[model samples]
Target: MFYYYEKDQKILASERNDLPYAQGKPIPGAPIYYLVEGDPVLGRGSFKVNHPGQLKAPHGLEVLDASRLPEFPLDATLSAALEAGQLTAVNTGQVGWESVLSAAPSAGKKRLNILAIGDVGSTLLTGLKLLGGGVLSSIGICDVSDQVTARWEFEMGQINLPWDYNAFPDVEVVPVEKLFDCDVFVFVASRGIPPVGSKVKDVRMAQFETNAAIVKQYAKMARAANFQGLWCAVSDPVDPLAKTAYLESNKDENGNWDGRGLRPEQVQGFGLGVMNARAAYYAKRDEKLSSFLTEGRSFGPHGTGLWIANSIDCYDEEISRELTQKTVTANLWMRELGFKPYVAPALSSGALSILLTLRGEWHCGSVFLDGVFMGVKNRYTPAGVETELLPRIPDQLFGHIQEAAEELKRVL
Candidate 1:
């Protein structure tokens, strides 16, 4: 392994000869990161690259494993960094990776902008306006319909607490051209949602084609505007739409990827939080599934492709499968009662998770993995996006996750 230091950051790479901007010396006690080439098709599965025991890497990328270091030892500081998620694997294959190595000053009290004030968007906007005072300086709302944006702006303005005018983030209607002006741009514009009583079993997937098209249009707009904020996908079929935003924004006029638009780490799908919440809801009601509340984790997409683990350590496949079924169909249970399940999703996935992201806290969201946006527990860091790596994931549980990724790959 080759150790290099760029400013205060320390990087270890497999290839020593043609390094990006790395030097030979390493800084003591600084955060350690392993640099590896990312292969979209072959790197579909997650691996344990920074865990305690043995380091693993995605297929064709194991040459950069930490275990291959000649004399490097997992000392106390390095172990602590691993547990704290400070140790990351930088994808040198990604565009704009050099920018990630540079120190980024915190943009305290950011401005947030929301597109479309429909059911999901409006509810999410309300949650953010009420709870985002510490993280957000202001909230901008934009929609194709003037009446809709005007109504939400007026309604959100009336939600201030008595004698506490500055307690919440103020909301205002923004023109379409200025939608990406803020530090965070949330894409909540969706179309072709099946009605409450529609016969469609997979509502999220049903809206994908239409929603993908809508997402592409705004994605290009974000490209043209050179949007530098986090792009949150809250529309139905969030995972694919998030990928669509990243892929579309990077295209040239002839639809060739130019790698000049939003980076993969910048686009995140905010649809998994509600799935995790719903799993917990079911787990709370069933004593047999009670372990999920603390030890469980949700993986994959928000809809048909999602999987839930009852416990990471003592994973009960039967109980976990049952819980997964309940969580996956929770939205359908609401539809059966003649209602669209938008409120919980908007708040749990869209608002709460996005707030956690802005605060740089651990949150459940779909991040780019392999060639698809796979939902997982991830957080933003000064270095970049860091995903949680468990000590061990049961083979059965991991298989379900792989299947979920394949399903998403087929859809996109």
Candidate 2:
């Protein structure tokens, strides 16, 4: 292995010859980052380096093969550093990597802006106002209808403790032009949701085409404003919409490709959290499925392509298949009762997961993986976005995840 240093940051690389930059000797006991080339179109992006049972180069980003790396005598210091979240793979190929290396860690409360005051948006706003005091300085609301935004502002303003007027983050109605002027921009504006009694089985997917067009407009606006905050996709069909925002923002006025917009790591889809929560809800009721509560995971899109693992260690194909079906159809259960299932999703996926993200904690969100936004357990760090690398994933479960990715690719 070889090492390099730039501006006091240490980097480890597999090769020393023909490196684009200068090389340096390894520094003992200091935080280190692995230098790797990443393909923006087909790579895992940047993430915290971990030791899994198997490693494969993300398609098109191969440098030194994973099999050639040393297996025995694992560096204790590197392992410890990884445990402390200090070791990350720096994707030098990404557009804005240099700034990431030089940028300071993000601290202090963040300002959040929400677009749309619809059912999901309003419910999510309520949850954030009640619980985001420590992480959010304020919340900005915007919508097409002035009356809607005004109603939410008044409703949110009344939800405060009598003794502590300033205990919660204040909610203010913001103009459409200033929506991007915050640390986080959430896109909850959606259209074409099937009514409760409608025959649409997959409601999320039904809204994709209309919602995709809506998000693209705001995405270009963000590009024009040079938005530099986290972009959260909270509307229906969250995964593909997140990718749409990232892709649409990177195009020129004539629709030519450019790399000056939001980076892949900057946009995340918040649809998996509620799916994960639903799996747990079912696991608590059945003894045969109880293992999911502690050892399972949710993967893929929020709708038809979603999958739930019954247990990572003791994976049961039959039980997992049953559980997956239940979780995927949980929203339909509410629709049968003459109601749209927006409350749990708003709280679980939109508000709680976003707060966890701002706090730099592990959360369920769809991140860029091999040219698509696939749901996974991920968290943000000073270096960049870091995804969980399990010791091993069951073959069947892994297959389901890959299938989910392929489905999303087909849709988008």
Candidate 3:
């Protein structure tokens, strides 16, 4: 059963007769519902309960059940059809993977493949190696760096220096050839980053132009190779690069474009992790301002004049002004602290984001917005990436976001 939701009423059912349920009458919500005709055990219907609780008249679409429901597992019909996997409880002590999904991804271990293991790439490798989740059998790391590759292959296999590697023992470096043919293709390579000098301006966005070109190159390679797996982009300027990869993959040889081969939905970017970090920094100053960590928002590029809006409920003109200043200047503070801010970005932007994404959790990052690449903090669910919509922001903050979009468009 599938139905369309209206703020005031259940407007109608899907015109597609192939769907399983019933139509909804007028209701005071924007939810659509789905009810499987005869599935009585779990209940005949499900409300589209997504993103905590905002649905007044929750619509039950079959897809919403993929991760949220216990009976539904990662069966092809659910995982692919509904775009779901069981969601892991962040509280592992209270609940484990067993409770999260209808079925776990399988205790049967399989090798994970990574492509372009640069700074972000290597950090991600470290996290995954430490995790050594049974979902991963082994890691196939690739990079242009023989030394870096060799070092990772040597380091990841050992049980010393940082964390217990034996617990998460499956990690290794591999050539690019082997890298492409794995279950997942983690694209952490970038055309440029970690600028050699301090004089580089807007360094994060500068990587955009270069990485976009690089992404276009790889899109063709993946398409030709018939790659059919998760393609995660971790390099800076992630959202646009993901868009470019999809765009390039779908372009015909003659340059005509269509949404085929690699669909736009196939890609995801990791830049939002940095924004989340900025928000966290602001959150710690005081209890009243803590929701900046608790409820703050950072949903755009990692460059100058970025968007950082404190929560409306907690919004104080002075506090927000200060928090915004601090969030924007955090990177510069790192350089002032006399070290490149690589590890945190790597951990915040790459490893942790990917882990959260794979676990089907909410995250701050870019997702396709308004029919193109737009950054909105979102969560990964069985159905696909869903961007979170914030309440109406203060007028000044809204102006900044609008300006940020315009700035991004001019470059793209």
Question: Which predicted model would earn the best TM-score?
Answer: 2
lDDT of each: 0.79, 0.80, 0.56
Worst 10 residues of 1 by lDDT: 60-69
**Candidate 3 lDDT, 256-310, residue by residue in tens:** 6643445444466776687668667657756756867656777565555566667
Model 1 residue 20 lDDT score? 58
Cα lDDT over the full model 1: 0.79
Tens digits of lDDT, candidate 2, 355-390: 999998999998887688888888887756767666
Question: Which one wins on lDDT?
Answer: 2
Give the winner by TM-score: 1 or 3. Answer: 1
Score candidate 2 by lDDT.
0.80
Query: Stretches of candidate 3 above 4 Å error?
Result: 1-111, 132-135, 160-166, 194-197, 286-288, 389-399
| TM-score order of candidates, top first | 2, 1, 3
TM-score of 3: 0.70
